[model samples]
Target: MADLWDGALIDAAIWHARTGDVARQFRYRALYAALPVDALEAAHLPLRPDRPGLWRLRRQDYGARDGSSLTDFIRSQLAPVGLSHCQITLVTMPCGLLHGFNPVSFWLARDDAGLRAVLAEVSNTFGESHLYLCRHPDKRVIAPGDRLSGEKLFHVSPFLPREGYYVFRFDPGPGRFGAWVDWFGKDGDLRLQTSMIGKARALTASALRRAALRHAFQPLRVTGLIHWQAVKLLLRGVRYRKKPPQLEIRRSEATAERSDV
Candidate 1:
């Protein structure tokens, strides 16, 4: 695994493309933080946990979202599936200037054997979230080329129905990180494609300040962009799908069913 503890910045770009009824595509540069589950307790960094700082990573923003130990929450989910004793790194957006919102965050679990699993914590504007666990059925290392898939149980966009599956791919490296999530319909037709690809560098105090200067009020900007896109889609005459009832079980798991080079 890469030495992620040295820094916490992922200078990344996020993109989304829709190929369904309406054709829409967009990309934006975004900054993210990479924090190992163990490093959440470290207080030496400019970014601190559960407190106000220029950059903040609140434990209540993830996992159970109840101000619980995120590490323990990750372990509880993995232990039941025989995936304990693994290292976890959370790649997410931290609260910038005491205001934050993450549409999605990733919990990357790895063991001495190799990449074991990934928990994609996805949230929507409805103030709800869901967890999708992706791994291999035979407990094999999840290579970059692997395509792990799971059904779409939670409603994300009002323009799309709650029927489909997501194909997830990850490229984890020491100096860079990349991930792709493509949505497909019941007929196996591609609907949407989204990705976050970026370079990793040491996040010193200076670096944090630079990022702040570049992307100030990032959380609000992100939220506004989301609604702005929705309005665009609405103006484009895309039908709006109502949000469904909350899922009793807000978590789902998928096995790596195939690999494509």
Candidate 2:
């Protein structure tokens, strides 16, 4: 962790563990960008916005995916929930020259008071996405200890069913970033647990360049690891669930839940 930076490179370790009939777990190091949507690019960094570079943030990668203004898209999502005026920050994997894929990305909306809401943008291998808006019932600042629950609407992993709710916890601290997700079945049993935790480094040419070297072809590597884990699960005789129909609506609000963590 380091001093807070409007834009930074997060060096993280992500992990997932299943606690059901078939037990499995995996962890890996990764890199992510904590980007300010309005100030996508800085002259001091090697990254660019909506252009080809060793590392870049393309507007088309998130929100509407139509190369639209990310700020406007985020504003629209927050308006109905009374958070339109909050500042927007996107935490996601930076795209390479050609390919990119993110299992999940976070859109944080904050006011002067503190973090007000978060939009969890989730995607699957089958090419579909969903947005889960998380906020307190009273639209108050979301404390680090608070947990939010939302109905699982999109089919993410074939190993998990669509009939569960996801309990989410986030820590968007100035010096570090962390998020946790637990899948609870309709019967009220926890099926899977996943998390991403990391320290932050200000976005700079030297910092990003070093990170890039450590994670060359990061997007491709991520996709490969996902499939590799899938192969391991299959070998373990885990039953594969079929992909269901696409979710018609893409966004829904999540409710704050009582938590002991």
Candidate 3:
């Protein structure tokens, strides 16, 4: 199938950029931490194809308690109330200046209040995870003659499609931005490994062992909202149930599985 830009992709990136909750921040940090340095640097800009300059970016590994560096960076970005990152989305233009730039057509706004919030939220999230903040610079901004600065960094959201909580969406992948699921659970939790770390290449299918107990109890009913809230509460409550998280077996054992495309 031919690759194309449906609104969903942009929506995913936007959603990730906007919602910067605690879970989101942790997940984002995990995903970033999980990425190899080479892969991380592979991320480039998504500038308009027709633009004159070549949009490139270099993402450095963010190493802070949670997102301390990110927070400081964002705070610096917001210092100029009249000059926020979202207000002016920065891109690296190696070729040259982009003449006749149409902010409207490009959907690049001067006052992306929502985007700014997301940026801050992402910073907040990264800080909490104690994961280091990676350096992400706008290639265009650093180009010899290009304008020195504007908002260049962005956030990535983690969410798995099935059997997990729905966190914000972010541009975790390079080609298509969308939701990513933070699939961390107990160390031996297969679900956790499959989702977050990577899928099992040799998931041995064990025949269902007949347990002494066989009767199935009726599934309890709960409202979606209430169920979600309860799930969240339990997740938080169980976090400290055991001290020291065990290293992931599946992630290390299975070897990295990623999109070849």
> Best-fitting candidate, measured by TM-score?
2
* lDDT (10s digit) by residue, model 2, range 1-261: 553338888888999999877888899988998887767644333566776667767878788999888878999999998999988878999886557889999998898998999999998988789999999979989988888998889899987788878888888888888999898888888989999999988887788878767666898889999999999889988889999998798998788684532
CA-RMSD of model 2: 2.0
Cα RMSD (angstroms) for every candidate in the order listed: 2.2, 2.0, 21.1
**How would you order the candidates by lDDT, starting with the best?**
2, 1, 3
Angstrom error of the Cα, residue 104, model 3: value is 30
lDDT tens digits, residue span 181-239, model 1: 99988888889999999988877779887887776678878888999999999999999
Rank candidates by TM-score, best first. Answer: 2, 1, 3
lDDT of 1 at 165: 87
Residue 54's lDDT within candidate 3 is 23
TM-score of candidate 1 to 2 decimals: 0.93
lDDT of each: 0.83, 0.85, 0.21
CA lDDT for candidate 2: 0.85
| Residue pairs with clashing backbones, model 1 | none
lDDT, candidate 3, 126-230, per-residue tens? 222111111123211111111111111222212221122112112222232222222322221223210122111110111101110110110111122224543
